[model samples]
Target: MSSVPEDRFRRSPVPLITHGARRTVLRADDGVRVEALYEPSPGGGTAGPAIVVAHGFTGSLDRPAVRRAAQVFRQYAAVITFSFRGHGGSGGRSTVGDREVLDLAAAVRWARSLGHGKVATVGFSMGGSVAVRHAALYGDGSGSAHGGRTEANTAAHADAVAAVSAPARWYYRGTAPMRRLHWVVTRPAGRLVGRVGLRTRIHPRDWDPVPLPPVEAAARLGTTPLLVVHGDRDPYFPLDHPRMLAGAAGDRGELWIEPGMGHAENAAAETLLTRIGAWLVAA
Candidate 1:
């Protein structure tokens, strides 16, 4: 048997695909500039639907893991990937998941602007939480509990939503990873590390009025198709989180628990991604 080349595991020199990949900068509702990349499907414009990818915390569009996920998603539909504010070339500081909904909304609107009849959002971790809120707040052009209706919210709605490794409620410190994550978001020293070491600029404060929880948002999603995916071994959040989200989603939701998976895009297998792509296409 032959072993795979070491270089194969390293970052590839060539880009994913350049033919129909268009790069652009989108302006969030709050005026933050979000760097985004869009790739048309391999099957051309006839592709089923557009898939907008919302990356996890500390992740950027250029991250290899994100790019790899986009590569897989692009196989089924046009894919749009973007960096939330405070990550990569995007401007402004991260409000963690608070204001990140605007970032996901911007990306979804951009995907819709491409003339795609249907748009679906797939988010990981923090991005997953943002995706849920974005869908709940804008899915049916309805205003959120905390905010009034806006043109951006009306235009940014998604037809389908998928969240991977998302937390059901906030401020959870049950797990070591969640505890460390809280530290990073709450402490000055940890914020410094997040900004300098992780290249992620975390907000120095907490959510003011507190955005809707994932479970609450899931309950408001109505008929929008929702997929709640989580790993049994995920260290950041336990199985209860996904259970809560799935329960809130009720008839419009589906849950998938990977036996040995760890977390988010990094832990998602190619087969799983393929299934997700199929789901979006069917949606």
Candidate 2:
């Protein structure tokens, strides 16, 4: 939890025409307030699609990596970066990826409210899982993993989705990073460290009904465009995760295994981000 350096990205007294940005707070379905940063597409309005960014575990809107991603996205399309509930200024505790869908839904709804006709969602790691579930449950007016569809499901949908470094299934402990992640989510002391040290708030224990896994959700995405990006060298989840997701997506999904990439947004390269932006725009 180090503060972002002031010199990281140059700031202006006013937002430049290349990337006009603003900040706001929106309420999730369950009444949790979610903090969000809205950056209009370069040159004022949405010349292309609007993008909603979902950060990884232990990340917030202010995180340097997240900010870098947002900055790159803004160059191509309008971007909305938000903190999932229990992270940053958002309220409530993290249900890990289960209840976090509500937060993504809220951001999507907010982006739509701003008059962006097309909305795309990009997520990293834990947020990537949330994005997939959100797209499945909310995109295309489909039913929830719990069972039948709800009104919320019918209303929130993303035109396209890109999940980077996301897990195909839950509770995976194969990799060292994932093993450490499990420790944080399962143990009380680990949760404390997450809250105080990483600024990540964890739920007490395991998911109750166990919301649908990302691969299952990807399978349900139907015609929605999906881009599954993972580094071949990723220390968490490995190639199987992205491959499973792409397989579930069938023809609607595309997979990109970076040659030297590591994990999540921190490992995503500028060229890759630009390519992702182009995909969303084309979608």
Q: Which regions of candidate 2 are displaced past 4 Å?
A: 1-19, 44-48, 142-153
Taking all chains together, the TM-score of candidate 1 against the true structure is 0.93
By summed lDDT, the worst window of 10 consecutive residues in model 1 runs over: 1-10
Clashing pairs in 1: none
What is the alpha-carbon lDDT of model 1 when measured against the actual structure? Answer: 0.85
Which number leads on lDDT?
1
**lDDT, model 2:** 0.83
Where is model 1 more than 4 Å wrong at Cα? Answer: 1-9, 12-17, 46-48, 143-151
Q: How high is each candidate's TM-score?
A: 0.93, 0.90
How well is each residue in 1-283 modelled by candidate 1, as lDDT tens digits? 0011223324745375558788999998788999999988877683358999998888888876777788888878999999999998999998888898888888888887788879999999998999999999898786463267776567789999999989899888998877888888899999999999889988887788898898999999989999999989888889999999999999999999988878888777778988888888787
RMSD of 1: 4.1
Q: RMSD of candidate 2 to the true fold?
A: 3.5
Model 2: number of clashes?
A: 0
Alpha-carbon deviation at 32 in model 1, angstroms: 0.8
